[model samples]
Target: MPRIRSSPNSSLPNPNAPPITTTTISTTTIHTNTTVDPAAAAVAGFFNNLLNKIPLPRWAIYTIFACGALLILLICLCICKKCCCKGKKKKRQKKTDEKINLNGVNGKTTTALVQPDVTDVDYGATKEKQRGKFLYSLEYKAAQSELIVGIKQANSLKAMDLGGTSDPYVKVYILPDKSRTCETKVFRNTLNPVFNEQFTFQISKSSLLNSTAVMQVFDFNRFSKHNIIGELRLQLCDVDWNHVIEEWQDLAGPAKFEEENLGEICFSLRYVPTAGKLTVVILEAKNMKSMDIGGSSDPYVKVQLALDKRKWKKRKTSIKKKTLNPYYNESFTFDVSFEQIQRVNLVISVWDHDAMTRNDAMGKIFLGCDASGNQLRHWADMLSNPRRPVAQWHNLLSAEQVNSTLTLKKKIPLASKLPF
Candidate 1:
């Protein structure tokens, strides 16, 4: 016989109390000697039921924890993104305000301001002003025989017609190198004109030769004693002199000489120390008949002496037409003060007024005194004529003559030295 115990929570037999099974039921006997602890069984039964109700795997619990962490990180990132966007928006707004303030202070309008193009104004007036300190904007154009440069103010401000005080002057600077700055004045105007003015600069070949090699312009007012004005650069290049001459050849054609062989002319001077008179003997090789000097109405030769290599002392001598033979001769006597002159250089150039040309008949001669006046050294070129003839003429003086006259053996001593 088996005995069973019951729990108070449910009507179930406790296993710890006893075991009951129906094996054979023919003859059965009941025995009640076993005891069971109900309190412990109830607790154990509660735990077993809880475990069965909540059946969770180890991997599922770990997955839930990881998911919770990811959700928390996502929430933090969203908050940071919002904060950064707000900050950037505030900074951009501040910059915009600053830009607006700057524009307002400068008196700048929202509308587009029409600026003046400086290329429209006259370059002549501007060029003159550029020689001074005034800043100028210039545009240049080169033609067949003319060069034009235009200039105007760089700013678009209406020319103010301020009275005498606002006398505007244009200055131009001729800058050859880093060391030299030559300035020239171009134009002056008291009243401001509505339209830009144009000035013309006319330069012949001779004038162009005297002009500066390079030119620049600047504003004079801007170049105060305390400050220097900005410089505008200009370049002059490719000067064709032959083309210029050809353009003006019609006006100058009649003056050209027609001589085939222009004879050579040479001279020797002897200074008399005792009398203070210089004796000059003229030398000519060919007959004056062949030299057709363009119908010379004023056919004369002028002899000039340079005292200090600076200013010339002049002497005039007339050449008689057809009076002398192929070999001509003339003499001249002049008084020179030795004290006033350190040395005298003689230059004899031939002039034909009708032909409008001057030919260098001979080179320079230096005159000084020795005792006898016979020891005067004549530094004359031995060539038959001037080596560099202007027209189609050849020199007749031989090399030996040039060398012999240039040496000391042919020098003549002066009888007496002049006072000054």
Candidate 2:
């Protein structure tokens, strides 16, 4: 009986279940499950398939990487080649422009033989056509002292005085203490005169060292009885030879420069008027390497003196590499006396085997004497001292006794006042 009663509600709603409400309730629950886009899914599937199914050999991977690197290198090389080619083209254009510019300029051309022997050049040419008409003055000062002289012009006419007379040549005189003297010119011009032509004097360092001992200028052709036309006085201070030697030592390092198996270098001393005696020394540096000759043969040193713009003396000596050190310490000496000399020029050279090939060093010195017997010399040291006194002339005297019966004209002073 009980089993029959419970079966009554199996197919139908029970009447006691709170009126058996038939309302339907709808509910939606959101669960956050990661959703993949179609594109992303496809990419993932592609990678999975590749990693899982496609088995690439190590050698194949290496080969592919190497090929990619080679391709990149080829691209870089191509870029470099293009850049280099462009650069070369630009350089060629620049060269062409320079050549055009050079062609447009007025220039004189000189051809010289390679490594030719040292030769002297005369300032005065016998022919008037070869003579130029330029004059130069050089001054130096040191420690409140001054040295002044006329610089000789190359290939030029001799300097002239105010009256158009040729001036005396200037010379440099050096003392044993390394002090110097400046020379004076006899002819006086109204300060600087205008010349029709131009000239240049060449001086180098080696020659300068030798002649720095003394320097002077003089006027050889005096229209008036007075011999001195212009005088330059130089005082030199702070010319530390020790410092120069120290600098040379620093430059040369510990290397010893000495000539081996070579005979003593010789020099001839000569006298110039209005200039004093000069002692010259010549020494050669040896034991040099082949490269020291500047990659050429026929290396040599030259020495010279210049008088005015028209006179010069030259001296030279051959260099032996086997006897030269990498450092140069060779030197030369000459005893030159100046009876009335004015200007002195010194030049040195290193010769190359090729025709007309030479490297040179030069210098100048000046000397002068005043009525007070004060001597003046000029060189680089003069630039520091400028207070030195120049030479002055005294009143001319009559050699003969004046007769009481005859009245004589008073002698006029001819020379200009000395410039201190």
The top-ranked prediction according to TM-score is: 1
Q: How many steric overlaps does candidate 2 have? A: 116
lDDT of 1 at 359: 39
Per-residue lDDT tens digits for candidate 2, residues 1-420, read 122122344677776765533444556678998977999999999976775664787677668879999999999999999999999999999999999778646543333333332342232222332223334444433332333334543223333445654444443443332332223333234323332221112223343343432322334431222233232222323344332111100001111321122211222222322344443334333322232344423445555544333224556555544333223334343444443233344332333233444442212221222211111322211212322321221211111111111122233233373111
For residues 1-420, what per-residue lDDT tens digits would candidate 1 score against the true structure? 454544355478676865654444354768889787999899999976865666677577668879999999999999999999999999999999999777657554533245433453455446434323322333323453343333334322123233432323222323232221212332234222121333334444444444443322222231121112223333444344433211100001111222123344545555545566655556443322233435323334556655534334566565545332323356666675545334555545444333345532322223332101111222222112222211112122222322233333323234374223
- For all candidates in order, the CA lDDT equals 0.39, 0.36
Position 272, candidate 2: lDDT? 26
lDDT of 2 at 361: 22
Instruction: Give per-model TM-scores.
Output: 0.23, 0.20
Model 1, C-alpha of 274: deviation from truth (Å): 2.4
lDDT of 2 at 303: 52
Q: Indicate the worst ten consecutive residues by lDDT in candidate 1.
A: 245-254
Can you give the lDDT of residue 251 in candidate 1? Answer: 8
